[model samples]
Target chain A: MTTATAPAVDSVEKPGARERAKRPGTGVGRPGFAWAAPAAVFFGLFALVPLALVVVLSFTRWNGLGSPEFAGLENWSKLLDDPVMVKSLWLSLLLTVLGVLVQTPISILLGVWAAGHQRNRAVLSAIYFVPLLLSITAVSVLWRAVLDPNFGVPSQAKWLFGDGNLFGVQASALGVLVFVSTWQFTPLHTLLYQGAARAIPQVLYQAAQIDGAGRYRQFFHITLPQLRNTIITSTILMVVGGLTTFDTVLILTQGGPGTDTTNSAYYMYQKAFKSFDFGMASAIALLLVLVASLVSLVMVRLSGYDKMRSTMEGV
Target chain B: MALSLAACGGSAASSDGGSDTIHVLVYGDATNKVEKQLVDTFNKTSKVKAVLDTIPGADYQSKLQTVISGKQAPDLFFNWGGGSIKPYVDAGLLMPLDDFIAKNPDLKSNFLPSVFNTAVVDGKPYGVPMRGTQPVLLFSNKKALQKAGVTAPRTWAELLTTVKTLKAKGVTPIALGGGDKWPTQMWFQYIYDRVAGPELFQKAVDGDKQVWASEDSKKALGMLKELIDAGAFGTNYDSVKFTDGGSPALLATGKAAFELMGSWEYSTLQDAYPDFVKSDLGYGTFPTVEGGKGDPDNLAGNTNNFYSVLKSTEHPEAVAEFLKLMYSDQFVKDQLSIGNLPTTTNTPKFLDGSANPAYSTFQYDLVKKAPAFQLSWDQAFPPAATTTLHQAIQQFFNGQMGTDAFIAAMQNLPAA
Candidate 1:
């Protein structure tokens, strides 16, 4: 009876094997083009189509009234001459770099520590994850209230805050922006690293222990190496998120104290909604998209992340 | 995509020609109930129904600009009535209200002339005043002023002295919501009006860029600089915002003695700190600048909100009938009940019915007596110029931009 059933199962599998052999690149259970069609269509309709229109709008003069008139690179030329535009680009880069530098180490340390199997670590990690649940607008408004000069935290801690004029100056305002973003977004990056850390094989650490490696040595040799891909993934997210940061600047600063905190994203909003210069805003938007894409691409290439190799490949 | 969906909805609603409804769009806020009531009143008498639509306040201007020329355009819509509607008027999307006024003269005459004239563009009436006038006033916490041994100032010199006195008492002399930028612009509007008179701004807005560099302009900047140098607003005004209740809270709590804001500040304060508004709030017209060219009673703020008709509206007669309600006695009472000081001729008769009778009477008298009511500079300029204008105002106040740089920025604004 067993031999008869085995032959029946083999006969059923033989046809599937022949089909797989017929199209060698089409592996068993792999989805075809039709599987991705929905997502692709959605992306085209929402993202690609709007991006193409924004490109077209960059070359046209539209005040959001009537139809757009072709202006023949006028908006682009104007942006080139705009000092605010130049300043905004630098500000965007500075804020993004600051965000990465500030958030990465903290996230990594927290993530690695939280990956432990202790009960207290789980509780603390849950508490730390609270910020990630709050909306960006809610986070910004909370920080704005907390940092208000006369009414907020600065008011209570006079010695520390020095009259609580944080938003009055450029440096402190930028600092507050970076600090708030770190406070809100570090949890998300930490979660990424935590998941990655837990996935590392216990055998590697056990082998390191057998070799008389200390905790620090084991972390550096085994854990750090394991988290390499996650670090890249997290940094890329930080880079993109920093580039498009808007709600925080809007609710907290409105790009004020004389355009001190006006990053590219906020500046684009100002041009589009505040100034009603859709043409100029479209130009800025296109530049941001290009810069973000180029940065992400360069980062992937530099990290060899696009190669899709596993961190544990040699092991 | 959402905008397109709205456009489709709007077209679908209006495509049925047999449907006897005229859409009336307004800026959505607590004030919408009044507009809704007014529309109900219009629909009661007319064969054509009046429908009220609102875009939330912040998005109102952008949404209006997008839909004004589309199939979604309303029959009549809310506007600030200066350069706010200039683009639409320039695009010929707005119908000049002269024809409506010609048929019913009260449409032009029932509202205050100054408030009504704000809607006149290129020598033609395009809007009728629908909402109240909001003249900027110097508001104070009386308790704070008493603690500082000072009264609300009546002249520019007295104001300076009051600031010094308030500062000596460890209070922020003036609560400038510099973070909101436009609140900062209120100072410029009053200062420029007093120092150069309304004609200087009028010339500047009418395409004479040279006025921004005129000696009068420099002198106005010098006076503002003197005020700033006096530490009148304290060092941290840029960290405060009235919209967020930061600066207003300062005034309410007696941490600050003064806030120069629009008449709307009364209601804002009432909402946030009713006790402070009831017991301590004191307001007066902006102090006179001695030897300045402008009249002391001249005002600067939003003149009034107006309803402008779309040129493509299918129901003009229905819209005109609806506008007539703007000046009716009930309209004035309803507006006053909401703490809005309507600019209709009959507004004074119902002042006692206002949420704050004394405040209403004061504002009514101020609006009536003012020689010139200068619209806020950001509103006077085309929408395209607001960011540059706001940035310049903020930079100038914060010492980020020098006088010459501010002048250049103003000169570079797209001509109204």
Candidate 2:
């Protein structure tokens, strides 16, 4: 079947290429640079322009009241010297790593299980997806109420929550942030893995079963390896989303008790909006952009996701 | 691109001042109804019409800063006074109301002195008191106090005894919303005021960094430490918040005995637990600290919200006319009807007409006679310092920061 279709595809493509070459102005089956103009213009206007302005603003001193005055690396020097800034970066990284570690396994297992043709799985999956439907602000507010030490679930379950100081201490606050993110985002990742798991060819599993491979062995050998690209994609999304988390921190903890839960994104917002130090905030923002891009680039490189090689190449 | 952006800003600013109307920007909340009414009253007789614009409460400050220097600048804008308007004053964006006051002394004389002085910057008045004063008071659930076999404390010694009594009764002595951070800072403000008098903070905010390490400061910290060591606020105060109705619920449900909160607590409780407010809510001035330098009559919290004029307003006469309404009999009644205790001397005349007459009268009498009304430290310092101030406060209360470390943080705050 492959051999028969190979030449047929070549014949179809060759005539189309020749016809296009014969009448280039017709532009049939080909998109010109003009086709991308709108998107390019939009990106330049919204993303690149503001980014460039932020870079410039990072070198200045402005408190949102007047014209920015060029201060020549003052903001950068101060940011480097700021202990909270350093701490915030580590918190951001910690939350991101924890999110990836915790959410990956649960999403993978749930996705694979839901990929089965079972009514119960579908029902449970629908229920699990409820958190994804709520806005981040709503989710944070809801969790805050639920975790209130005196009036919330903690008071009723003292043995488990132990005073329900989830947002009072640094470790627990960080844990709450990671847990909330995982709870809110896992459904989207599970959906991704479900699609990927369903696409895993059934013949491979059938052959493995015929060879006396158990379900666990089949999952480890077949499903895990088949979902590599999807794992990489999901991880990259988690990495970026984790880095730029703002609303949750703002609503749940406000970067307290005493800056314990102050992540880089929240710190940037505090500087920009709360403190009204736009120049310093711009510096923090530019640093965030650089860090996010570098981390993603390294991830893509390490995973060989940029190579775009298919897992089913030999199938 | 930057130049074009600047040009756009310049043109926009010029266009805003081109009209005959004076725009009044206020923090949008329930009180905006009264502001709109005042504007309507001003527009009734004036040829130069008054326009009222509102930015939602949370975004008001940031929005004001962004537009205050540009074409979108309001002819007059609402502010919390003190450090809230300092940056604008420094930027020469605000009009000193001395000239307006020279023509209309009622703008200064009509409001309570303590409340009016909050808007004074650099020896010149910059704001007119508009909203009600919000002094921090010791609010208690009367039922909770009775259950604990204690009344509201009148002195530091009495407060400690009450804490002990309340704790022995298995009730948290104080319902502190430490998670909000600012609520934690309120304790510092009241303690510092009661122990060291308002001068220590005044000097501290006025660039005397040494005051944070002064003997009186240490004494105040020690007193606070004593209260904390006695577990006055219980163990999980840091996990509760006032904004989300956590600490208030604790008080209302009789799980805790007292909450040091702003005058707004009355309104907040009235909204959520009306029965509790009517029968059980009790309020009083902060307990006096024995042998302390501060006056017993000293107060701390938001003094009041003020309407400050922009330096570039085309119609100062119309703006002045608008400000005159702030102290008018109608303004006081409107403010009182909404449960706000306006600081106007005329406020006493309409006390009978207030939503809660007794509560309004109590607040008015306290504010009227107070020798010193210190604004909240966060508001007394510039906005940039608020984050550090709040963090230091939370850290100290939670024992995450030592006294010395907290003092260092305080000293590091950007000057007012």
Candidate 3:
């Protein structure tokens, strides 16, 4: 009764509490959606329309040089029997697993290192960011030289890839491909982690310190929990990125030494460009997109990304 | 961007009806200059202006596919004549040159029959042979062979001896660009024709599956496996690519002994090792297989590039006039000036005028006297089979797959 008596005097909603995104059409109304209309239109035209085209093209036998023949369910059924295609999907999945397992931890460690040594952060970041500056083609070419049996690290040292040169030998090709990719991409993920860590208020760490929390204790009780959302987002990014890894494999291996390193995206490219079978390529692509989307969704659900975001927004 | 798209649509008949601009698309390379010059020369005399478009070399085929299916298809375009034009032929998107050839008989009679016939699908002509013939030859370093105390091999037994002698002297016996699968295919194509003869491929092309799964095909693959097992190409052949100049660099550095390459190797050597070309670069035909029924003199390669007209062209008369230039004396001279051995009837006379007359004459005589000219398997098969055929060739060379697998792969290719 006391709270109700005070509320009738002034009824004004504060900013940022108008979370229209959470409960649509429930927030304060102002200007129309003209601001977002252009972006939505472009997203439909450039992204959504092309995606639809690919789905439609999957049902036909398109050589990309003539009229696409309507093959009904023939192309989709063929994917089941394509051993090379199936193997490529598996390889792509393997790369994703390795990327997440290796790249995520390294990025988090880098972020942690950057935080404690604030004076050297700029210098450290500059070093880590070097790989991110190089183009994928350049990175592939550089790594190819580094792994070359004739005059590379393997040539001098005999242990690394001398057992098998990166591209020529099956056992090392996939690993070398992953290594090259991780080497090139780790910096970007590290930057993301660093940015996320920086966003946390310093008072939280001070309060934890004042409670006699050690560094390890603070990291476990504060940093890791605070960085949960960042970790989930980075993991999702890395997973999806690994699924469509093409340039490194294309330049380094050409998916060769007999399909040992052909991932799903490269496999689709091969189907389209090398085989000129657009229908089959499109089918493979759609399947990969489905797997990628499903994986990201599952990861998000398991990490309670939506629930955390909603709880945080409710404040 | 929308304006350009509208322009493209408005000129959907850019080649067909309204526009006088007859679009001509060719693969972009060092050859684009010559193509442009030829078009300029044509444009000077003709009312129909030939607008040339050159797509980058790496993306040529894919871009060609896009343009052919899209609104910007050329009135006339450059192609490898065989499998490249087959799909368009089947689709009836191409204008058969029967009527055009009837008007200008030289389009058929001027070019080499086998070379000219590559563009002829299902007994009808669809294109005119434009560029020069590119027959595959076994190129050797004279110094390497001399140091190894061996001569250029002329038979399968001699090749094995050369390989043995070269390997013993610590030289890579063969400089194969296995990384670029087509170079590996040269070994298969020559071996297949040498062992099984051209009739087997011809029968396969004529829809006889028995030829692909035949004993002869298996034997050819067996010989290839033996070559691989013998360490003829050394341990790292798959890492070397011809297109990137890696294999050629190996040859230039004297790390490798011989390279089975095309007639273009002369120009490549000229570019890379001009002095070495004079002193060391020597080429010969693919050696004969022992007890093979195929003619030892039989040659295998790309016949030449061609200029095919689209049925969508507005000015057939103008395109026919331009095609006739493919056989013109001026065209022959221009082609010869660029180290091209044109496949025209007049090519023999113009040989002395070529950039490398000796090399040109040698290639000309080789093509002239060959009992049969087997079109390259990739060029002969449907475009869809190129990847499968190339993979099979590489797998066989690398010992990743054996004779049975190779035969099965070839057999599974989309039928000619």
Candidate 4:
């Protein structure tokens, strides 16, 4: 080919060289922009944009009918002194604690039991996972009927509490909410824990038994140490899930017998939908995100996650 | 790409559902069939066709607001009228119906004035009644009351005595759906209207912040507290909701002898407990308190649902035609067929042959002669205020707050 024609061919072959040169160093060796472009665009469109908008919306007063107006500290200031907000925050914290203290132990035991019982595994797993398969509405209705004071199990057990309804009284409402939530969510944690438990070498348990270690000793020294990372992760999931509990509480008590079970997530929902105060709701949402982040950080430190990471790096 | 997509649909332009066809959105449920029938009847001869759309009842309100603020708002929509459309009215998003009324005077004159006035916001009509009136009434499961040696009470004293008698027989005196919160608010609305009178509610809704703390209001609170202390609703009423069928089941099984429910209770019972409905159901108006200023004939409940037009609609005339269909004789009959007690002046003639003739006639007469009817408080006040109002009412009923705290909470309701 002639020289001029070859130059023309080269220009066509290497199009947009100027644009390519504008990017950071060694751009060509990295995957082409088009490779991750779809994911980046989708992520930006859905997750990042919504989160950014929520932050912006937190500073405005929008009634969802009219244009949102800038109201610098109005929503934040109102949230600071709000009694419902304070009560809801406490309630959410209580739920997170309950999830850790109650649901974790149940999940661990179930996971351990499921690991040993190969013969009954199918039936036991099916029974445990029923709540996950049932629609939330169905579960809520079932639980409501089961707890009904006039004709439910409470009536037959009248001699124990003497016609006392579990869900009606304010003092018991929070406990009932926690119990119902744990009942529905324990299977999820069980599945998670079972994965970690099953991964542990069977030889280790056999070795511990030969070394005169009991089943409990084997669990504490071998199984628990091996499952530390999984347990930490499960706790984090439970705590965050606890903070955002909504549907179960809403369908069961509607956050009441007078806000007795009003978690912060449900509180934010009420502020947005019931009151049409989107600004306040967004503020509550951002507050929850911040609190959850701080809590996760503290949890990791307390669980020796940093030391674990350092040990892995040293290896 | 997202920006471009939004930009393409940004203009208030229809993608040719036809310039002659404008959509009407309504909350979906059993009532949708009646709405469709009426729309089909209207579409047959009209120049501008009306298309009906429905969102499930649970998500309707939130979805309506989202679509209104976004790009998909309907030309016309269903609403509970008073405070439901207030924000839209304030934002100039709704078209006032005054011109339509002026052009068609029968639209105003055909329905009961009390029911039609529900859509009046700031002295201007923004909505037209489109369905049946739902007046709250006293309902009894007859055999249970008979077992207790009591009848449906006509006065508050007799009601208290009946509660005592029912409790002695191990029956819950009233079936309350406190979990939903709105049903519990019905008791407050009726008691307040009977004690402080309907005007007090009107004034409170009109932005009189001090109205909730008035002497009559305090007195009403006291009487409500006395009823709660007397165990009229039973200890577990807060967890039982009609929406979930818990409270209604209580009434059906004779665990609850009395229930103050909307007139829809007639249809609900007819559907769920047909045999019991035939053998043991009875109804009455709310009982009056002694020395109360309000007339004994006054009632409290939802008047009817309404259709309001969007200001951005291209087919105002089409919306006008659709609204006019709401008052037609055909509309009245359709409402009656569903066991609804319509508020149109012509509704009375069709009642004798409705789904439940006796129940229909009872409600029709109850609403017709009532000197006043209090629209449900949650519907009467601003929609944004409803959460606090519901919270306050629930707290008071659960005995979480004293009378003063309840008064304070009511006074702080968001301005209309």
Which candidate's lDDT is highest? 2
List the candidates ranked by TM-score, beginning with the highest.
1, 2, 4, 3
What level of docking quality does candidate 4 show?
A: acceptable
Candidate 1 structure quality by residue, lDDT tens digits, B258-330: 9999999999999899998889999988998988999888999999999999888788888888889999988
lDDT of 3 by residue, B207-301 (tens): 78778778888888788778888889988777777876777766776778899998888898889888888888888899988899899999998
Compute DockQ for each candidate against the true complex.
0.65, 0.66, 0.36, 0.45
Model 1 regions more than 4 Å off: A1-31, B1-18
Which residue pairs in candidate 4 have backbone atoms (N, alpha carbon, C) closer than 3 angstroms, thus clashing? none
In candidate 1, clashing pairs total: 0
The residue-by-residue lDDT of candidate 3 on A104-212, one tens digit each, is 8899989867766578778878987999999999988877766555545765776644533356667677778888888998998888888877876687789989999
Candidate 3 whole-model C-alpha lDDT, 0 to 1: 0.81
| lDDT of every model, 2 decimals | 0.88, 0.89, 0.81, 0.83
For model 2 chain B, the run of ten residues with the poorest summed lDDT: B6-15
Per-residue lDDT over B97-154 for candidate 2, one digit per residue giving the tens place of the 0 to 100 score: 9898899888899889999999999999999888999999999999988876789999
Model 3: CAPRI class: acceptable
Q: Mind sharing the TM-score for model 3?
A: 0.90
lDDT string, candidate 2, A1-315, tens digits: 344345435545675755655665543443446667889999998889889999999998988767889999999999999999999998888889999999999999999988999878888989989999999899999889988888788889999889788888888888888888888999999999999999999999999999999999999999999999999999999999999988889998889888888999999999998899989999999989888989999998999999978999778
Error of 3 at A11 (Å): 9.4
Residue by residue across B157-210, what tens digits does model 4's lDDT show? Answer: 999898988998888999998888889999998999899889999999889989
Better of 2 and 4 by lDDT: 2
Give candidate 3 regions above 4 Å deviation.
A1-35, A116-121, A145-148, A151-159, A200-222, A309-315, B1-17
After superposition, the stretches of candidate 2 with alpha carbons farther than 4 Å from their true spots are: A1-31, B1-15
